[model samples]
Target: MVALAKEKQKELVEAEKYVSEVYEAIKERNPHEVEFIQAVKEIFDSLVPVLAKHPKYIEHNILERIVDPERFISFRVSWVDDQGKVQVNRGYRVQFNSAIGPYKGGLRFHPSVTPSIIKFLGFEQIFKNSLTGQSIGGAKGGSDFDPKGKSDGEIMRFSQSFMAELGKYIGPDVDVPAGDIGVGAREIGYMFGQYKKMKGAYEAGVLTGKGVSFGGSLARTEATGYGLVYFVDEMLKHKGLSFKDQTVVVSGSGNVSIYAIEKAHELGATVVACSDSNGYIYDKEGIDLDTVKRLKEENSLRISEYVEEHPHAEYKEGCSEIWSIPCDIALPCATQNEIGEPSAKLLVANGVKAVGEGANMPSTLEAIDTFLENDVLFGPAKAANAGGVAVSSFEMAQNSSRVSWTFEEVDAKLKETMASIFTNSIKEAEEHGVPGNLVIGANIAGFKKVADAMIDQGVI
Candidate 1:
């Protein structure tokens, strides 16, 4: 195993040297774009065998072209607050890649939203969408607008203004945006209303994550979390384990983490920890799903409030410390790069059997390597958290067909989609002789499809 690992390391070094020119050029072209650079490095390091298999990709300059977004848009979103105060925020959209189908991704509305973060997310989306067996391409848009503590009117106004400029660039067949982080059903509704008002057409397919009363599909809210559990379940079953009676640690209290907790509990896994921006709560008896939902989803409170209801639970002051708690499974559902080498080491020391990323690139490269070296089952974000986007595509189909399927139907389809994703990732990994390494399997599998599609299209 040591010899094989050393050989793989040598291959990665050679791969880096092979792409050094283009990688360096990307850095010089886009200075200080750390997140985007990190994302590119991860996938580029995994493509040595791929480039060897398909020389046309390199000859056609697919890597260079794919690294640069087809289009980038930025604008100022101006709105009026409930107190009659004028406010302004920056909005950005990165139509990153569109080799397979129309651009599809999410719109995040948080203060941390930046062009670098959006570009990284958009880049990851390209491969993630590819792995889903869906025809959606990749794009991402968002704003530096913090919706926390804002009144419904304030959020609505902000959403309307954000969409006023964004609507011109997106359409049902062009780019479809869904919810991320701070953006949810409420924000999607406002944006959809603005898009309709601006375009003067009721194109429900233009945006997803809408209310079921309109065009939204059922189980969309639960897709990412549930999909993650489903994918991890596949990994566990392969390793002769299961979620039953397992202790889990889930970071974040957003829609993804909340439903992830619900599903993990349903599968008989005790989710012991969940966090938010302010801090994290550790419940020894397993988190009370109702208390968490009431505090986060219903009341929009910090995760620290979880300790108020559960006296036996403990609330840590910072979210970064949540990784120190012992658990069998660690699900990082928070933001990007939340788990670094330190956190990964802590989880490994505590005998974590698996790590499933519920957020985009939640684990750093070093952290992922640590987990892999320790024989931990690692489910990368592009494959695990794809449930939401899969369902978004389903919602798009429902909109196009002018029909809504029952919740059972949508949910059953989502389950199958997630299972198919797992099967494809595992199959591709084994076929490429990187058995059990879904990172390489997923990247290669997704890249082959898009690269072939791009080559066949004759260099647009």
Candidate 2:
């Protein structure tokens, strides 16, 4: 195992050397983007065979340019609260690539927002978008503002102020941003309204995840969650198992967790646990979707509220303990690094057959190593969470055509895309003699398409 890891590390180093010239050229401009650069390098290293097979990409220096964004926009968002206090936050928009089409990605608003996080997300978006076989390029933007306890009015003012500066660089053709993390339908509405008011015209395509009354597609809210289940279903089918009768635990009480729970229940799985940052609630009986949704969306209450309402449920104080519960399937729908090596060991010891990431990089490097070493079926974040961006790309298509797709139509498309992504990743991994290494498969498959496009376009 140590020898195998060394081999993988060596391959990664070689891949970095292959793109070192491009990395050095952009290093100055992209200072503090080491995480983003590291992820790109790791994926690029795994694609050495693909690059060798497709020499045209090398002939055109696609590897060099694809690692760098086409444009990066930074601006300040200042807003006045209802208390008459002025607040300031930093905002970012990283337009990673536009070789396939206009930039398309989500805007993540959270207290943790930083250029490095946005760049990592945008970098991942490049491959996730490509895996869908769509024409959308990759971009991501957001602010450092936290909307947790903020009043609707306060959030509205902040979103408007943020858009006032962001409007200058984004458009349907140039770039498009949607909702992510702290940015939801409400935030999107505020930003969209501000963009229209500033431009003196209405362009629904400018932002996605909008309300249906505006331009949002049906199933957009549930796309990420449903797509997650669909991908897991495919993975299970490959192993001759299914979601039926499986006890599942999911983290996060937001959109992803809510719908993930709903779909898991629908698929005949008992979702035993779900959580939020403040704590987690577990019930022997499956969690009720309607009750969980109301507590989270309507009351803005924590998971503890659910425990209060359901006497049978138990609420744990810390968020990390959610992984300690025994389950057949575990979905990490929360933030990055929420699941570490110890938590991974607990899941493996308790008989977790598969672990799918519903959030971006929810597992740490050690956790991933533990899962891989245990031969646990693991779905990496890039492939698992690609559902959200895939639907956003679909929304972009609907907006471009000036038409909205029915929920059934959009949902069918999303399922098909997720299945295709799973198949492609598995196929690529098998080709590289790493049959279940979806992390490598996802990186290679996603990188090949974008790299080819970059090569075809030539030298930025």
**Highest TM-score against the true fold, candidate:** 1
* Angstrom error at residue 457, model 1: 0.8
Q: Per-residue lDDT for 1-460 in model 2, tens only? A: 9998887767655545665666566666677776675566556656766654555665677766776678989998899988999999999999999888789888988988888888888887888888877888988889889987889999999999999999999998888899999899999999999999999998989999999888888898998888888898889999999999999999998899888889889999999899998889899988988899999888887789887779998998999999999999999999887998999999999999999999977887779889989988888878887788788878878877889889999989999999999999999989877787888888888887777677667565
* Leading candidate by lDDT: 1
The TM-score measured for candidate 1 stands at 0.96
Tell me how candidate 1 scores on lDDT.
0.91
Across residues 102-165, which tens digit of lDDT does each residue of candidate 1 receive?
Answer: 9999999999888999999999999999988999999998999999889999999999999989
TM-score of each: 0.96, 0.92
Clashes of each: 0, 0
lDDT against the true structure, per candidate, is: 0.91, 0.86
Model 2, global lDDT: 0.86
RMSD of each: 2.9, 3.7
Off by over 4 Å in 1: 1-16
Look at candidate 1 and tell me the lDDT of residue 404: 91
What local lDDT score does residue 219 receive in model 2, on the 0 to 100 scale? 92
